[model samples]
Target chain A: MSRTLSNPPSVELLSAVSTFLINDIAPQVNGQSAFHIKVACNILNIVAREIENGADLNESVCEALSNILSDQKTGSDEAQDLQSLKAELSEVIKNDQIKNNAELLDALKMLTLKQLAIDNPKYSGYHQALKSNER
Target chain B: MNAPTDTLIDNSLSGYLERLQTCCRKHFGSQVEVQNLSKLSGGASAETRRFILSDPNKRSSSAVILRTSSIQQGAEFSTSISKDCEAQIQKLCRSKGVPVPEIYFCLEEDDQLGEGYAMSCVEGETIPPKILRKDQYATARENMTDQCAQILANIHKIKPNDTTISLEDQSPLIQLEKLEQLYRQYNQLSPIFELAFKFLYKNAPKKHEITLVHGDFRNGNLVVNEQGIKSVLDWELCHWGDPIEDLGWLCVNAWCFGSELPVGGFGSMDALLERYSYYSGQQVDLEQVKYWQLFGTLRWGIICLFQLNCFLTGLNRSLELAAIGRRVSEVEIDLINLMEAL
Candidate 1:
């Protein structure tokens, strides 16, 4: 975990590739190809962000899920994984098993914010959410 | 004028143009010519093209838009109406004084152009970013909210009985139910979506006056000129539902394109509601519109998933479609914000 590879990391490599596509290749192309290159650049950026923040975000989500499940007295004995916890939480919400739970709402908002941070930090709602969080 | 053999005019496009020329000749007389037929940026449901139709005898030429169903018929989830029906609805909406394009003719099966229609093209900018950022549209931006409100009022004024085409009437709860069903079909779990579904089901607005909803009415769909809105395009999603649905859809953050203004990045919600009330003569409910805004946000997220499913399932291997999957998180954040506000 300390140092598997030296010099440029995955994030740096992805960033370099995205930069190359957008700055170098984009202007050379036109129309649909140009548009797609931009999209490819964006996707690369997202992947880079995911690589950087995905583990921490998932850990935070798992912690939030654990907190919510325990608060609702619905925590399972099997030491559920992130996907299973999310599925359980979804079912809980779907069945209206939890009502007016401020903690649950906050956790969901945090989860969504963390996701937006990875997927598209530039999205207006993500920026707005971050601004509001500051207040 | 003969069709130009430019690089843009590929074999398939040339063949399409030839068939279109024959179709136009049948309607506009033997001397009618089709020129500058180029594909326009369009949604998955339809192929949109712009061309000039000229009548040599009359020495008259007109810009026209040809909107045809994708020949291969890709899975378009929201498009409930056929292209023929869409044309009929546009004609009906025009009769009701809605600012839509003038339909020239609906293509028959024999034309081999697939199901589609040709309409007189109204020139304007439809791109949201340009309209939102450009200084040329400053005055238009000021007036667009009012124009959108009035146009939506006019659109809602057209009663279901007035139109020959059948518009499916789905109440808010029913719409939510259908959306949930569609979301379940993909079998992807998002706790945010689940929470949204729960909130929507609990607080679903009671069905008020059902009217013709311009299902995709937003900043990007409106054709904006220097003066104001020239036309409303993309009627494929039009249906009978809560009239406020259109107003809420207009306010969706995705449509705002990073603008602070909730109403299509042009004006405030209060202004939109006031103008809508003035035009439609119906007092607007702020809560109802907010409900639909939240609903629209969730609906858009599900649509992103659907688009991703299309890519993942190998139905349409489009990078854009795959990229849309990332956009679902944008909607999720918007949904969270909307719910917190409510």
Candidate 2:
């Protein structure tokens, strides 16, 4: 109960503050300050969402990375952080090793799209990709 | 906390307008009064001030725009050219009948106001959403793609010798290398960006034809009116390079503003290419354009990351810069879509 109590409460607080800023405070300001405050509210909303779903997203990214890099020696590093996994994947890409590998390509595309899904779900390509899957 | 060093400079609007009045007195024999000075938004480094100048004796007033970089202490990424060179480029483009603001004068360093220049302000809607959707700009929106192509063709037609200012040519491959180095300098690994870099390297095009590239020819950068594109603004990124670079950069998905249209949220790529080839008398190469589009997507993605770096490294540190960090993913998704299509 204690573990579950901490995270959602903070996310809820951020959501309330972000909404208040957007709906209430934003209309009272004008010009550059108004635009900036709107951006600030958007940032808070993104942070709130990230707080709610960050752990699951990270685990999904790790699983995707592990599946893609299964052939490499560093693939077995189960304890590798997200940064290390990214570094390993980038090094592999830089060396021209992943060419013509359909599985790795799909893995990379899915992983990047997952990031975009979190960062900007409204992105055109993300919606297009979703539509294609449905078709 | 210490304030930014450049902000300490005299930024008082009245004081700067007085200096502009002194400059105007030299241009026009009679004393002129500056009226209605308002700072336009965007341009973190370059300051765009719109004002009107009137002589007491003469009943008429001219709308003039003054751009100043007095506060930009040092060059950050993207803003690589000087104001003097920008003036020269605009002057040359004006001579060639390219839709550009007429250059008045470049503010000298000795005049006490740090480097900047002034030009006759052309009236038009520069906002993307208005240009894309509003009834006032509907006609301009319809003709934007064709005019954009034709204007770019005319811009690329300018020879290096046409302008007195010596311009550096940044080829597509060289530009990619510089961008990759900047990415590495950030010291953070992005597998998505690395994939894009690798793809670009593998598909790098040979220089099609060396010409003046309107480096930042995109939606927000163009001034459009009811007729069509009134003028092109922001010559800071102008350089000599492959002409298709401009065409490719224009069609980049980032310029689309959530619209399905590939060419600046107004028209189709086929229409752009058709118009461009007709205007420039050069054949369109679809594959090369695609490569540059991919390259442009990656380049824009890196720029976002670079701005985030500017925020994280405490170099600029604004909410706008921090907000731009989120846009890197849009480019990433766009790049992946391009890759899958290829």
Tens digit per residue, CA lDDT, model 2, B1-342: 001112122346557767777787777755688777666632556777777888778877999988777465643677557888888888888888898999888887666666888899998777786688888887888888889888988998987776667788888788988999999988777877888898788778765688888898998888888878999988888898888888888888887878899888899989999999999999988887888888888888888888889888888788888888888778877887787777
**Per-residue alpha-carbon lDDT of model 1 for B113-231, expressed as tens digits?**
88999998998888788899899999999999999999999999977777667878878888898899999888678888998888889988765887888898998778899988999
Error of 1 at A54 (Å): 1.6
DockQ of each: 0.57, 0.54
| Best-fitting candidate, scored by lDDT | 1
> What TM-score does model 2 achieve against the real structure?
0.93
Candidate 2 wrongly placed segments (more than 4 Å): A1-8, A72-78, B1-14, B41-44
* Candidate 1 regions with alpha-carbon error over 4 angstroms: A1-6, B1-10, B41-43
